[model samples]
Target: MIKQTFTSLAFLCFALITFNVNAQDFKDLDKSPMDAASFPTSNRVTEKVVKVIYSRPQLKGRMVESLTPHGKVWRTGANEATSITFYKDVTFGSTPVKAGTYSLFTIPGEKEWTFIINSDVDVWGAYSYNKNNDVARATGTVTEGNKSLEVFSIAFDKDGAMHLGWGTVRVSVPIK
Candidate 1:
């Protein structure tokens, strides 16, 4: 019993010391923080039709076009590719998509943006984006927002339209 007690005490002391040493390394915060957007748009609502998880990247004195770029597939957010989960089958823009989780990708254009719901999940970025894994593709109108946003954001409006905004650029797609 004495030997076991000493071993336990020593292990506890080592764990506490190791944890104290490692705690200092976690001082920095993620530059691009993760955020979520759900349909219903209210905390009071228990049920949700859709939800999106993504990281918000700040502009920080950078141009939106230069960061996202036109005619290229963007991850839709920073870090891991943006993921959207649907509770039920719904019409996304003009395309029908089943209830499931998917990685959201975007191809930005001058007048419109092509939003792709891909079966690929847990992707780091658009680097491994595959066209064959696309579940559905939809087009969203690109417009200029009245106010500029420093960080990339996503929200669902009251009309069930998903909006993506960053800098002065806004893109909208209807979901029903």
Candidate 2:
């Protein structure tokens, strides 16, 4: 009876430690900031566009499949699923993306990545993803990263170009 009790206690301790570790990971993400205005929020030289500036540190370590699963929609970021509001129609990899806000998600693969622009916004996560509302889909070639990225993030260049990159692969999406 004593042996069984000790084993149960050990198991409980291990579970608690594991839960705490995961909780800490999420806490670190929560501490990250979301500053949308500091970054270039507009590109008037070409056409008026609603620029989206976002960054999330948690995207670094979290496994895409474990946290966001395959064949599902993701809210791009933690709080609001990083959103981009466009004032004019734009093209995303040959697909005509209309003027509006869209949630971006990616289906990651070993060699290729499918970038999805979904109409749904304000979602909690990929749990409620709907494929029928996808506005555009683009395929980007993946390149190996020199170092593994713990968090996935995106940034725009000073020239008003979109860059989707992590680890080592950096895909550029020019604004027209």
Candidate 3:
């Protein structure tokens, strides 16, 4: 009787462990809804610049009211602020922007978008956003997107330039 009980208990423990392992494996196979959702986005790479844009679903609404609300610090998207990498120094809105990787953030308003260049890099999101580390800030105009964007995304223009706009506002950052 004792032998049988011990063997049964060991078998039960092994089965439980196997079940737990399989459960974890199954969980890994499941994709998050956010990850599965498709967003309109694109990317462009050139000898001088790499540009990306995040167009949210709300872009179909009014530019000033729908896409970017007044007096809000937008992370640019779910990830780190919209990012751009330049191969050489370039001038942005009369300010000289140096070549390097930088996080692009914006303060959206009715009239314009205040584009920010920060020192932080490779961050998971804007959770670590620090305004004090800002390298430069430039004001740019907002324009309507040619098509509707379902998801927030970034893309580069034909000229190796960066354009970020959703709703009613689009800002262009040139690559040197």
Best by lDDT: 1
Cα lDDT tens digits, model 1, 1-176, are 99999999999999999998998787679999999999999999979999999999999999999998899999998999999999999999889999999999999988999999999999999999999999988999899999999999999999789999999999989999
lDDT of each: 0.95, 0.64, 0.59
Best by TM-score: 1
Q: What TM-score would each prediction reach against the true structure?
A: 0.88, 0.61, 0.62
* RMSD per model, one decimal: 3.8, 10.8, 5.8
Candidate 3: RMSD over Cα atoms?
A: 5.8
| Model 2 C-alpha lDDT per residue in residues 35-109, reported as the tens digit of each score | 452125444354446566454645555554464454555455455566777777877777888888877776765
Off by over 4 Å in 3: 1-48, 51-67, 122-128, 167-169
Clashes of 1: 0
lDDT of 3 by residue, 3-84 (tens): 9999999999999999989887744532211221111223232243333433243333344455456677676765445565
TM match of model 1 to true structure: 0.88
TM-score of 3: 0.62
**Candidates in descending TM-score order:** 1, 3, 2
